[model samples]
Target: MAAVFLKLDRFALRQFNTAKYAGTRIFFDPDTFESKVNEYYGERHALETEFGDRPALVQGYAPFCRHLFMPNFTGAKVSVQRITAENESLLRTRYEARRPNELPVLVRFFPSEALGGESALPVARYLDVILYSREQCLKEAQAMGEEPPLEDAPWRIISIKAQDEPYETPMQPITIMRNSLIGEGGSGVPLCRKKYAEAVAYWRERAIIT
Candidate 1:
């Protein structure tokens, strides 16, 4: 089985939801998706000759999920279902509970990128939820050692405020994807953190502003 990783940045989740439904402004480029894909997979020989050796690039779920959620509601919802299935049985139950009114949707299963195999990865899964209070959010973050920012802070911080809080209430799961870190070069060094940081930096530099 492939290992999957989950990344839940509270700041990014807030930004995603706000921009998604409230007409808030967030910076992202649709065309960068292709640029990003090329960066991860490596440049074409023709493009490389034209542009010279570009920076070693990496890509990950955060930005990809953001792009995917914009116009693809069904896909986003299904992704949420997969993640929810892992923990709360209620989501699956509720989904099934409404099968009379809600029709089943097809979900695509792509091979794990980290494992480079045809089998699905089962490491970490992604989820986005909104809580009722900043206090609650802060509490969860503190438990996870991911405290939110003070009112004056400039950078956005996402934290698991409370581990014991109910998964229900105002919170609703958004999208989920399996994550994993796989080592390259047989040295047995874990490369997930390095790749994740590289991917984050790539987007940060592009001013893609996530």
Candidate 2:
């Protein structure tokens, strides 16, 4: 059976989990979830090579891009909420003493009406603030263990675990890599996890995973 997912923005949903789906206003659209997963995974050979030597083919998918509208390769976007997480979601972590530039992204919440193909705000357990440039990243981000220079990509995502007191400064960092989610996509309570396990198992049974 196709599992249910809130019919919200897919890029922002890299932080997907049940706590973010708390309210009744969100739609559980299996079709949309399936659709996004389709783009993210692409064809079987594409997955094996990670779309190797064919950046344009992979960049054609919105899941692997930087643009808010869709389809580009500068980077990808993710969203996390600023609250206590209920389960083992991305909210269970924090960032370094670094912060994003003051430039704001879209405001997110569960929408009341059908987005109908319109983009809707996103939700997650923690907040992933994106810094767009190497210069800005140098100014705002704290260096960790001589990590490589910031990529030429526009979306530098930092997953920050936050508090409720209206959000203070000096954000910390912990990573939740998107490529790592290829086959590890369950983040919910027992029932939700069960359904997710069922879906993954179904695909595996068809030789999608070895």
Candidate 3:
């Protein structure tokens, strides 16, 4: 099966709620999305500047879809995992300190250029959907003081990023994709970090990347 991965912040969580609770799919043009990312980067950069100006880890690429991409609402194979508040801190630590060997393929899936919101995006090629069991969905709905749906249907959280600020309340439960180290693709497009390194080395050996 084709598997895609996703990451969710607060805003993304909200969008997910809309999809599951209200049944809507929010779409954006590439330019508008890019603007939002730039605005966020500017705000974040300003705050970081106050602390101490440092070089950026990613220079040109916008940090917009660092986690997830969904190709379609239905008929897509996806894996989901939720980054809970408890593990959030640990995740941050690990992300910062991740060794090449430890880094997962998703985190290391850097594009050659920034994804400028093109229509023919990677959603079909390399995206994952978030799914939840019926029980989990009902539990979350009750927690939010909302009535759960009558049917015990599974919930598929759509792709959305959290807002610039932290979410005020606890989020509904969600899941993330499992780590996929190697997947079928073109030579330069291996699925995981180790294989990515190998591909890079292979290309360098063949004078592909100098």
Candidate 4:
């Protein structure tokens, strides 16, 4: 199977809470999701202004939803792997590196023409967090009114070296859909990460997640 990996800094980690100890995983209703996207790119841009350029932490269209459109409370499917030696040195550096090569280049996913809150849409698409097209994203953003542009959005550079494997399966074709649901739930009781095996066993016994 083809898979795409995403590296998140501490800020993105906070929103996803992929790590059980990171605390609460945010509940994004379109609006909050857009806000967080804007926030992330904004800070990344700041880091870029200081440093000349660097490679992006994540590559390929990501933020995939093998389960949650964003992710759920326990962050199932989003496992935390060890900081690879290959990617470690670049991940660890001063807040504002004196040398340009010390940090990675921060960049925005979309163009300046996107305008208004329209910017967040492209960022979402870049992460594969959004399955819709540029047109669809713009439509949604239009309804939301004018907001900060992608370059202008206030958002981060957190010390982190986390890996998120999105596609356990091959990529699927994208189509236009009217509405969708994204959120939290795992039966009546919300099982913690520790009970993962038990939950899987229960589901397998019933063929729920087979």
Candidate 5:
């Protein structure tokens, strides 16, 4: 069965209507539509392809870029309670220690929403995060002995393991984003080894690991 994805944007969900579903909120066969939306958002921001050939969907809880405004991402955004100035500084330090020039974006809590459409099977919410430059992410993928990222590809979605903390830093020498779980649809788990297994088991228990 084709994967079913829930549209989590609370403000406006017009973008998720990839198939022109006559006002349909849910989407079927989201592969092409996801690619197109990611591409549109990438180009809208004039995002440079520094990492991979092009921008790819960042399927995660955080809104890594403008294209991703779903409830899951937005809900996490709302859940981020204000941190103490000292703790905030420390987290910033931890992030900057890895990426000297970049900062990590924090997202919190996953959304609890039903999949409304033909495939109403507890759909997971996906948010697209854009890693503008593919240099570091691609290199890490290669070091894992995975195929080098395709040349000049339109976009590449980076995945990571889910975490209670929604903060994400750019891919750097330590590799904030690593390649995990090679799948048939070029799928991967973006989390580090620490959380990869946990994410897999969680999804499997819920029968969401497709």
Candidate 6:
């Protein structure tokens, strides 16, 4: 099975387990979660609309581009979520034990710190706090490396892992628009353009535009 890339946005993630001062926030309307899976199948644009302004979601574009542009690269199904530490642990354990033949697991992290100031609150600041806390967590994890509880999972950590290598920022407009048109045939081109126009108009109206 292809790997399922779990993409989490800042608004969906909670604060670090041990970081009392940092908290995460979601960017989409909370109500969207009530019927995400169902609506996603019927109207894929709904998902793009939900992710449009999120910088974290935008970051996925670079990896996606590599997958699309590179030869012989297998594609992956992208899924989004907002989960707590306990939920993450539970999911990881289940996937590892089951080793389901259908799909590979690729968990991506979206820190609130990356959301920047385009959002309503101090998203970037909160992310910085979370990062600081995460650094501490990593140090502890490294120290406990050989301990029974410190065993690491086998999943490939990409799309969200902290790395020193330089990466070109993904092109948000092209990715969202192009992905929206997938499977729609030629008619989607005009429709995508219209949607882009509407997005521009909406941004102009809010003046809170991306």
Best by lDDT: 5
Backbone clash pairs for candidate 2 read 65-75, 80-126, 80-127, 81-126, 95-172, 95-173, 96-172, 96-173
lDDT of 5 by residue, 1-210 (tens): 322222222112332434321111333334554444444554534543654433333444323222232223221111111234433332221112112223342322111221222333232243333332244335445544555554453333332111233244222212224233222111243656545555544432231111
Model 5 is weakest, by summed lDDT over 10 consecutive residues, at 73-82
Model 2 worst lDDT window (10 residues):
170-179
Best candidate according to TM-score: 5
Over 4 Å off, model 3: 1-123, 154-210
Tens-place lDDT digits, model 3, residues 32-130: 443443344455457667877542112211112122222232221111123344423332111211122233232321121122222322332222222
| Superior by TM-score: candidate 1 or candidate 6 | 1
TM-score of model 4 vs. true structure: 0.24
lDDT of 1 at 168: 19
Predictions in order: lDDT:
0.26, 0.27, 0.28, 0.27, 0.32, 0.25
Models ranked on lDDT: 5, 3, 2, 4, 1, 6
Order of all candidates by TM-score, from best down to worst? Answer: 5, 4, 3, 1, 2, 6
Tens-place lDDT digits, model 1, residues 1-210:
211112233343433323222112223342332233223223333444677753222122332221111122111211111222233322212111111222333222211222232123222122222212334335434544544644422112232111112231121111111122111101122335555455444332221100
Residue 95 error, candidate 3, Å? 20
Please give the lDDT score at residue 125 for candidate 6. 14
Name the better of 1 and 3 by lDDT: 3
User: What is the lDDT for 12 in model 2?
Assistant: 33
Kindly list the per-residue Cα lDDT of model 2 for residues 1-210, writing each as its tens digit. Answer: 432211223223333343332221123343453354334434433645774533312221123222112121112212222332332132122221111322222222322232221134233222222222344334323332223443443343322222222222221111112222222221111233444455444432221000
RMSD, model 6, all Cα superposed? 20.2
